[model samples]
Target: MFVLPDDDDRQFAVTLARGLEMLRCFLPGERMLANRDFVERTGLSKATVSRLAYTLTELGYLRHDVEARKYRLGGGVLSMGYPLLAGMRIRQIARPFMRELALQIRGAVSLGMRDGMNMVYIESCSADKRSDTRPDVGAVHPVLRLAMGRAWLAGVGPEEREVALNQLRVGVPDQWQRYRPQLDQAMRDFAELGACFSHGDMQKNIYGIAVPLSAPVDSETLVFNCAVMDHTPQARALLDDVAPRLIAMIANVESAAGLRQTVTTTPPRYPRR
Candidate 1:
């Protein structure tokens, strides 16, 4: 669930936050949602949901479906994202490399950054054109569960990392309790293995290895990952081959983007848990 700002905050706009939160009710893979759906997802009153939905539809942020009595994200929502994507020179610089690596490993390679308590995919490349399993751009995954998110959590400064951890501990206690051990292991893996691994954890039959960029991009922490959808015995052996390749790729990206002094394969140091 997306968290909203406190209503009492001096700078917080209550009605604006409510409308935006209503928009966030649409999850990935969902095409349309009715007012009742928003109410259920957001814990808002039926009347409030309807009002916000109508307002969003009128403002061009949502498209109304008269026949279905539902709404889908509109062009205005998509248009807002273009500027962000266009300004990310790293995304443009990393795509070709991501494509090459995706082809090499016959898997999917992605670049992502933290968004609140989740990691959102900014770019993704898949080895198979027809594969539906690979995450598309804008896909969000829990930070405590997936390799990409774990890499971001592992790469940040201790203070920022602790703040996020505290948020998780308080914001989503059940998830934090369930996945805490895996989070600890991820930190150790980053410090010792140079990459973090997630096998059949975040999603079933998925294998992933991720490493954070050696340096921040535009003051944002970025993570690069390779993911394969497989549950066979061969998946175990993928770690060794993919880890070094991912590290090499991160070094290349950091060098090309001028985010580091020199291209080095040494992993970023993570705080000992």
Candidate 2:
């Protein structure tokens, strides 16, 4: 059940609401949007949007695209996120392995987790084709239409994955009910493969695979995944070589963390490579 909010909780909640609103203002697809698009997309007053945009751009969360007269993610944002992902060793342990996986597999390799209903990319190593539209760390992608999200969904138990699916309703913009059949198919497929994959789902011409992390974790512990693109039967082989390395990297991360069951009520965090 959702907790009833006290004053402190209420105030904190408000902060989160605004922060989220601000985040939605930045989309990787657009990366940079002009003021008009920003106001239209956000449905905020022009003045409010302008002020927030300016403040964020100045604060280094967003950058102004002078030529396009739009805004995009700034280096400052990466500066802040790098340490967090690095601290977790998820990227550290996974990077060398991912690059090796990408080299061996010759496709994109990514490590990701569910965060507040979206999949937050923690690490990525990719080939030229995958890099053409590569997802960056700190990029929050819809759990739907992505193999990385399915890996998380598939790795967990049925009851637990369902809870995550339910939570996805609130976290994702659209309702999950609409895609129940597809999700069910994915769940069944994951049960068989021990991993999940998708083609042209998150983006056209993109494909991937993923697995789980978090040993000694609870039923509710989030699923983690590694994904590789499928460009050819040759590239499809990347998943085979990459999967074992990803499994090993996850094991290394778990061993580093000592397999303790410390539930972080807050979301899991990862630092950069």
Candidate 3:
């Protein structure tokens, strides 16, 4: 039995929630899934999963593959994202600045927001003429492992950070162990420098530095990161020089957005057990 929220004013929509969950079952790099896959992922009955799959396919949210007997995300997902993407003022305001920063660092810069355990890229700029480092707008990186995520977590309230950490502890215990120490240090770095660095933490050869931004309008914690493919002397210089610039850029953004209040003090750090 599905448990509804305890709030009396909240109206629950079971079908809608299940449909969204079915959609979320498709992870990064998973191009296709069967009804059985949805059933396994969601713990829904096979019959219910089949019905939902058919309904979603008819609604243009899922594309059915007749030959492969699978379903992939359809164009309707783009429609769902377009309005949200279009309305993000930060992305619009940060574009030119990100472009300039990318060019200055001769690498890639991105603005990201936390989505569950992942940091979703909302906007990106690449200095490479070929745009080799540019990630897709909706690309996601693990929150505990990426520089942007660390910066974001560093800025969020203590309760929210604890909730997220608890979720990590329950969901991905091994990863939580691997990342706990680094995250603690990143929290300290963010407290001292207002920025966090990831030296080949996410990708083997890639290095990145990130700073959090205060988004008062929506109360969303956002982050900006500069990523380079390799840890060279140039990368080290960029990390040293660009991190301060990144913090200043975020301050400029907050000022432009009329978010006068800043999160100067770091949230209480989570202890490594």
CA-lDDT, candidates in order: 0.82, 0.62, 0.80
* Inter-residue clash pairs, candidate 2: 32-71, 84-270, 84-271, 85-270, 85-271, 85-272, 86-271, 86-272
Q: Per-residue lDDT of 157-246 in model 3, one digit per residue for the tens?
A: 899999888877876688789998889999998887777878767877777788887554476788899887775458765556677667
Model 3 steric clash pairs: none
Q: Write the per-residue lDDT of candidate 1 for residues 152-209, one digit (tens) a residue.
A: 8899999999988888798778889988888889998888877888877787888888
Q: Between 1 and 2, whose lDDT is larger? A: 1
Instruction: Give the alpha carbon lDDT tens digit for every residue of 83-152 in model 2.
Output: 7666664556556655755665556667676775678877777755446445776778777766677777
Better structure of 1 and 3 per lDDT: 1
Which candidate, 2 or 3, has the higher TM-score? 3
Which prediction has more favorable TM-score, 1 or 3? 1
- Evaluated against the true structure, the overall lDDT of model 2 is 0.62
Off by over 4 Å in 1: 1-8, 231-234, 264-273
- Scored by lDDT, the top model is 1
| RMSD (Å) of each candidate, 1 decimal | 3.4, 8.1, 5.2
Instruction: Give the TM-score of each candidate.
Output: 0.88, 0.67, 0.86
Give the local distance difference test score of model 1.
Answer: 0.82
